[model samples]
Target: MKNDLERAFEEARRRDAIELEWLGASIQGRPTFAEAELLDRRGIPSCHVWKIPRNEAPVHLTAIDALRRWQAGACAMCSASPRRLLVDHCHRTGLVRGLLCTSCNTAEGLQSAPSFVAYRERPPAVILGVEEMYGSPWGEEIAPSDASPEERTQRNAAHVDAAEGLFAGITDRFRPECADG
Candidate 1:
């Protein structure tokens, strides 16, 4: 297990360095620039992200931490990764909450902008915060919610599009095999 510990330490260092790099990049164009300055201003320690619920801080890296959270049955959104996760937040409010990966968080951002015509349209469920059987970060069952007819219709349309794409890809992948049949 010593080797495993060594690997974990190395990975932690790498993640820390990379996170710092990203932090630097994010603040580079701002008035005050410098990675160390950003981290100091944000009060980020070496181990975890800081100050925001969805800002990817408080990421669990060690197997022990992951195992403990899993044992306790954590929310799936948080369990999807091990190294670290970038949580998202409400940019308008700037509240230190909205834990999600970079994508989900960004999707929220893209979806949240009211001034942007494209993002102004939001799904009813997201606007309502209605809980439903949506996939969690961890591989656990989530009971979504009852949707309105319109929402159901939209969901069906999306499913159909996705299934069609999947089938097309599969058919393309197996075209040579199909020639024999």
Candidate 2:
């Protein structure tokens, strides 16, 4: 029993040492085995390559690959410009998801973390009235008393029509069949 326990401890230490060495090399900008494979096959840029621990050696795609795949100058989330797009992945699995703008990335990360969920579960200590922050921006443009029910309905319908028209004009590149003529 003592000999078995000693062997297991030694094995664990050896594994930890190897992992630490790998991490050090990674931080020092050395490519992993999987990354090297990608470099040879795809000629992916060194700056855009990264390794993730998996049973089978895995590497995330290059920036050029992402650009080719997504084929737009906008984020996968929020439809914002890709000026500051970040590589997003599953925190638990290290699987690449897609590129996201900074705001969407931060929001997604926060929503998935356990502490953020727990904090949301607890009741708020204080709540502020909507009036305190909102400050009636629509007060000058529109007034409820000025418009009758029928007029209000017409205004709403017009707004909905405008929105639909805007969406219709935007091309859906993902679906070739649905591409604009």
Candidate 3:
């Protein structure tokens, strides 16, 4: 009996509730640098720390936790179990690629780097069904491998821009000087 507008409002409210829950869980589950170091020193693998109680977590968070566990807490590229791993995502499509160490993440930003080429050839998100869980931004028909050179260049440029934007948004709270204290 609900009108279209009423159904739309209900859907929007449902989505907002999900987003708020996700944000709260993310903030609560994330550890500070010092906390991560302490966990590391205690001979504990911090990989599972990204998760909250499964019943309370959103589907996306649970999916990420599953993916992280599948990767065995190591950098997807170098297999280094760094205290903190960055979530690598496609800048053009906003789909998560995989977890990476700082060095690999930085290297991947370069268009000519082997990491970038590898990513373009086989995006982890697409391969591992992460994109399916997250929902694809675009259809697979326009995948990077099938794109023209100009399209690839534009995508690479977008990636660099997105990475720079992310780095620029980091506040002093996350800087090494502040983290050390």
Candidate 4:
């Protein structure tokens, strides 16, 4: 039997094909060079492609579906518009991490791969709250731009603690043992 992730990948590919095919068809007869280039570059197979570190590249549909359900079509990194988002995965394990916009994806690619992998493995619970503000604890006034270094550090530490608490809550409630009760 196929595993849950495999099943999700299959279902997402089937659904995303329709959208991709539409994109392909829309550029079929355009005279602009950009349009034709888009068609040639994307084709059908490449349009939804998500490359892993390995030779096999997965389609973008599964990650897209997960994001749609969990994040209301917002980019995980910047919470920007969901347009042209791509799947971010671990190259070593090919694990689907999250949906990121092109810029965010590039930014992430520059960071340490292990950090991204760790974040993806046990995603923070705050990720579930897409509408909530993500970043530092001090929203606007806690630390002004000119705040002393010590003040900023304190605020950052507090934010980290709060984030850890949120993740702990999610892990405690959703752990396998807890689920059986």
Q: Please tell me which predicted candidate would have the highest lDDT against the true structure.
A: 3
lDDT per residue (tens digit) for residues 37-96 in model 4: 343244311112211122111244343353443443445544455467666654323235
Whole-model lDDT per candidate: 0.36, 0.41, 0.56, 0.46
Would you list the rank order by TM-score, best first?
3, 4, 2, 1
Which pairs clash in model 4? none
RMSD to the true structure for each prediction, in A, is 19.5, 21.1, 12.1, 18.1
lDDT of 3 at 137: 35
- Across residues 26-137, which tens digit of lDDT does each residue of candidate 1 receive? 3222222244234434532111222111123224333223222221221112222334444332222221232344543454455433222221232211222222243324
- Report the C-alpha lDDT of model 3 over 1-181, residue by residue, as the tens digit: 9999999999878866775654444324445555655654553323334433233334544446645644546665555678998877665544567777897688777746444565555554444444522322343322255566678567667656765787775765677876773
Ordered from best to worst lDDT, the candidate numbers read 3, 4, 2, 1
Clashes, model 3 = 0
Each prediction's TM-score versus the true structure: 0.23, 0.26, 0.40, 0.31
Model 4: how large is the Cα RMSD against the reference?
18.1
* TM-score, model 1 to reference: 0.23
The candidate with the higher TM-score, 2 or 4, is 4
Residue 25 of model 3: what lDDT? 47
